[model samples]
Target: MVSPVTVVKCEGPKLVPFFKATCVYFVLWLPSSSPSWFSALIKCLPIFCLWVFLLAHGVNFLVSRCGAKRIFAGLIFSALGDAFLIWQEQGYFEYGLLMFAITHILYSSAFGMKPLDLKAGVVMGLISSFLYTLLYAYLSSPFTYLVGVYTALIAFMGWRAIAGVQLCNDLWTWTKLSACIGSLLFIVSDLTLAVNKFCFPVPYSRAIIMATYYAAQMLIALSAVECRDENEYKKKIKVT
Candidate 1:
């Protein structure tokens, strides 16, 4: 049988690699980096890898610990959505949006699995509605409609999470909130892209938008790790 000391040492080794991977991914976002197709490709590489890493491990983690299958499914869909959004090929926006919508639906369902207060939903809805409306006013044509729908869906997911409050521990709560905020930043980044594509003649638009986009994806990955950690902790507690 493994002694407690041995278990602790094993845990330490696991954390070192996790932190190292995270740091490596985070450092790629520094400004002043040259813009090349290769650079852009590298920037998105971490998120794609992270998505795969988490989905493969996260499902097992959840199944053995929290038994939250829905959460696992949501994460898988969200990761796929992220992957779609990162694709740079022309005429793929609608397909990306469709995947993102599926992600929102899964996220919302996961959030709803937790018990929550009704008022949280109302508050989130109001805030999301106001923000999206203001944003939509500045966007052109069908892009505005597309973004409006996306915003509403994400807002609803966030509200559901807030209301359900499945993240019982403070750390988990923080992680969930960070992921939600990251998701919002991603939406902003995409909106910026749409503006640039359709209406704006702004300089450095790609840089600005990509900065936010990368940051958002990084934060979401961090949150996923945190959520997994929290679930693992709870499992240990239950076992003890």
Candidate 2:
């Protein structure tokens, strides 16, 4: 088993920059209803930059720790999703959602899950199903079916993130919790996007969506790195 200290070391420094960037970008780019065209584009720039940063970070972690390829692919897809979304009003909304859908699938695969606690998993599934139904009820055609499928994918991704946590000591458990929280934040980000797009616009919804979105991506990226390191450490112990 990987020691708890190693897990902490892997997570500590990486998390600081991720969280710092998330916070700094959110404050600097709070969405304005009356932004000039150039200003709007400038605001959208940070998300792309953050995605690129995380993509590089994930690739480096994989290089050093033998991380799962799916995690790396997820980050790439996320960057593509951000790129597509920056032009969402220019009719790239569907393409953006499609990219994010693929990202969620890759993420779920990397954070592989099993039905460890049947009762808990069942409860989580039921809850997600209910929420999915509620969301689908409000959406209209073209978007209705697409949004329905995306919501279900994200819900399951979140569920699996939680279920994938190993039964280990506290620090190691936190690594899993990071993944779980990240996945849930992703769900929140998309849910807010759906509400802002389909249901009704909340004032300054973009700020909420982007804040959660970047934070989610960063935490998930960090979790992927730490997970890879922990697993490698386990293999080393086994071999020795």
Candidate 3:
């Protein structure tokens, strides 16, 4: 059996602090009367901390275990995306999107989703088509093409994540569930950002976007802890 000390040591140390920082950022950003510079500082500070936290988790995952390398890599890409997007005013939006695109690709690889069943495939295709049509209607020329490509990647990643949830034998486990939820929330957060940027304004959109994004990242990170190697995990199961 795994000892309590081992569990404590292997688990992420930054989860609590990350959430605390997120809460503080939200409080700072959401209030209408809050100073603009304060809000910007709060936003940038937490993301810097978040990237650091993810890097630490990636190191822990890499040194202590195998089969989690893709997850670690994904976290690194996610951190880069977070850092780039934090400075959207400095013409970093495209760079940020590229980082996130890489992030989604890494995450999709980590999921290791199987070929989709027919119904799931059909549904995902229809959803992707509808989203593309809607987005294209709203976007301008270059962005129409650019965002379309990005959306395709996002849709593929989301499909893979959902497929993992359906096909993984550990569907009932916290790890699988967390990844699935995280994937869904990631999509939601990105869509919100896209709509706010490309379509219309949503009040307190930044708060909504950041909250969902942070939650998604946290869940994805937690999944790494909740799940290790399938072989090792199965061995533990058999021993118990």
> Model 1 — which ten-residue stretch has the worst lDDT?
1-10
Q: What is the lDDT of residue 32 in candidate 3?
A: 36
Q: Which digits, one per residue and each the tens of the lDDT, describe model 3 over residues 85-149?
A: 66666777788888888888887787765645566556766887897787777898778887888
The candidate with the higher lDDT, 1 or 3, is 3
Give lDDT per model, in order.
0.57, 0.68, 0.69
Q: Which ten residues in a row have the lowest lDDT in candidate 3?
A: 1-10
lDDT of 1 by residue, 1-240 (tens): 233343343243334443454456456654423334444445445455545545544466656633244444554554455445455354556677777677677656654545565676688678877876766667776767887887778777666545533444533355566556666676667657756755556588867776776566554544444333445554654554
TM-score of each model, paired residue for residue = 0.58, 0.73, 0.75
Per-residue CA lDDT of model 2 for 56-134, tens digit only, reads 5556656664334676677777766766666677788899899989988988887776535455467667876786677
- Give the worst 10-residue stretch by lDDT in candidate 2: 30-39
Model 1 global lDDT (CA atoms, 0 to 1): 0.57
| Clashing pairs for predicted structure model 3, backbone only | none
Clashing pairs in 1: 116-163
Error of 1 at 51 (Å): 3.1
Error of 1 at 219 (Å): 4.3
